[model samples]
Target: MLVIGLTGDVGGGKSSVALLWEKEGAHIVDADKIVRELWREPEIIEAAVTRWGSVILDSDGSVRPQVIARLAFSDVREYRWLCDLIHPKVMRRMERAVFASNRWVVAEIPLLFEVGVPWWVDFVVYVTAPPDERLARLSSARGWGEEELRGREAYLLPREEKIRSSHWVIENDGTPEELRAKAAELAEMFSFFSEPIEVTVSCGSEEEARRLSKAVIDRRKAACVHVYPIESLYWWKGNVEEDHEWEVSFKTVLPLYPDLVGIISKEHSYEVPVINMASVVKANRDALLWLWEELSGEPDNHAHRS
Candidate 1:
């Protein structure tokens, strides 16, 4: 799965972008939701009471996030202490959610860069809007004035640095439809390259390997086929056998696996060819995009033998 780190300045509409991706079938690991859940735990509540007293609790006996925010944001030392208490737990939960998901995952972490990018994230997307627009959003959404917004943002990494570290930067100054379009485009691209696989087939000879590779490419069964010489040893018919062979590896997505196997089986001379598939956990974006483009056309809608 492709894991994306989605972050942005306060009131920049990162959550809106995440929702769009979710609509496109991506799983959203929302950090704020996780934080709220953590805060509701008994141990966390007890710890909060110890640190800041019972005044942080609501009438319903739940921890008031706004109360904690107010107290923490007012003092740099208090803010750091609060983060120290909360961020590690949040990181663990976020990693668990991201790693457990099979679908394309979008992690909506507002302080992603501040806490450091997670190792599992494949890419980072930084959302931003014009200062005036962001200030307006903060005012309308959180009852925060310009000074308050600026004060809170002071604790974050600079906007320019965040943008520089990101793989994709989205400007949320446009209409919601425009922002949604950007999210949709990214979702599609990520989904297309999500499950890359490397199919390795052993051929009896270089000539056979070349022929099979050519057929696969011509039919668009795979994005690319690499042919190389190798020595092999195997047990066949109760005897050990050794031979010089050619290895052909196909770079393609999992959806095209059946087609690739069919082409190899049909064109190969070996009765029981060595066909092995390995999942590619990571790949270069440009190369994967090229692979996707090469095999973008519809697959053959026909049956194939084992």
Candidate 2:
């Protein structure tokens, strides 16, 4: 699965982008929501009460997050203490959510740069908008004035630094539809890596393996193919079969698996070739980009099979 660390400036529409990804079938792991749920735990509430007294609790004995936020944000030492207390627990839950998800996972962490991106995150996407736009959004949505917005933002890393550190940066000063379209496009690109597969086929000889590899690449059925010699042992014709064979591995996406299989079946010297496919759960981003680019074009139907 692909795990994206989604973060942005205050009121930059990071949640909007996450929601758009959710609509595209990506699972969302929201850090703020996790924090809210953690507040409901007796242990967490007890800890908060122990630190700040019962003043941090509501009349009903529930933790008041806004009260804690005001206290923590007012003093640097208090903020660090609060983060130290809550971040570990929040990270644990985030890890569990990401591990349990089979689909693409988008983790909306407002303070991702501040707390450090998790090692499990495949990439980071930073969202941003104009200062005026952001202020307008916060004011209208949360009734936060400029002074309050600036106070919260002062604790975060500089916008330029965050943008420089990110793998992708999204500018979100447009209409909601436009932001949704951008999210959709990004989701599609991420799906390419999440659904890529490595297909292995055993050929009768080195020459056949080479030929099949060329055929697959020439037709754009696979981004690339590697051929190497291997010893095979398997049951065939109700008897143990042993042979020296060549293995061909094709790097391609799941959507093109059938086309790759078709090329192998039509070109392999063996009547019943050994064909196996495995999902590529992780890969280098640059390599995946190259592979995706190679396979992005239409198939070369004019090329003859040889």
Candidate 3:
């Protein structure tokens, strides 16, 4: 399973990117949504009323988030107090979501670095756009005045700092279609495993191994393939057997697994060829980006995948 932390500045389209990943079978754990549910808890509303003296309540006796935000962000001490009261519980929920399944998961935590989310996240994806573009989007879509936008922006870390800490960057300065393309790439980048899969196939001779490996790379199904000599020992027809064989390993994405297997099965010289896969688990970001470029027929940026 891969756990990716998705975050960005205000109006940078973090939700849009998250939606794309969700469409690709990634479970989205939205931190803002979790906090919204917490607001409706009776105990939480009661606590807010008790501490803030009913100023943060509504006519129907519910907590008013707008009122609370105005109060909390106005004073450093008040903000810390509010965070202390709710962050621990919210973090617990976030942790549960990360470990809930053995599939790709994307957690949209707007304050990922500020709140110090778990370090176990496989990688961080920071969405970005020009300041002017973000400001325009906030004004038109969110109806936020310049002053309001500045107020929110002042609370977050600088864009350069966020980019420095991120493992991947997604630029959201273009049209929705362009952003969707980036989102789809991101979804594929983190699906199933953060690093590429190492698929190994045993063959009767080096000729067969080399041929299969060349075919995979030529078809753009893998970034690279290696063939090596090896000895195999396994039970067959109720008898243990030992034989010299060649192993070919291909580095590729999970979505291409079925295709790689099919090709190897068709090209093998044995009745039942041995094929298996192993996860890379972790690797250099540049290396992964290089692999993606090779597989996608993109020009080599080498430094970044975006």
> Deviation in angstroms for 201 in model 3?
3.3
Residue 240 of candidate 2: its Cα lDDT? 100
Cα misplacement distance, residue 170 of candidate 2 (Å): 1.1
Q: Which tens-of-lDDT digit does each residue in 101-171 have in candidate 1?
A: 88778999999998989888877888888999999988888899989998899998898888888878888
Q: Return the lDDT, model 3, position 89.
A: 82
TM-score of each: 0.84, 0.92, 0.76
Point out where model 2 deviates above 4 Å: 298-306
Identify the leading candidate in terms of lDDT: 1
- Candidate 1 ranges with C-alpha deviation above 4 Å: 218-224, 228-245, 269-275, 283-306
- What value of lDDT does candidate 1 attain over all alpha carbons? 0.85
149-233 per-residue lDDT for model 3 (tens digits): 8776677677788888887888888899998887886676565235478898888898888888888888888888888999889
lDDT of 1 at 239: 98
> Candidate 3 clashing pairs?
none
Q: What is each predicted model's overall lDDT from 0 to 1?
A: 0.85, 0.84, 0.80
lDDT of 2 by residue, 1-306 (tens): 778899988999899999888888889999999999999999888888888999998899988777898999998888998999899999999999998888878999999989988888888898888999999988998888899998888878898888888888788878888887777777777766666789999888888889999999998878888889999899988999899988999988887888888888888878788789998776776676666567866232311111
Pick by TM-score: which candidate is best?
2
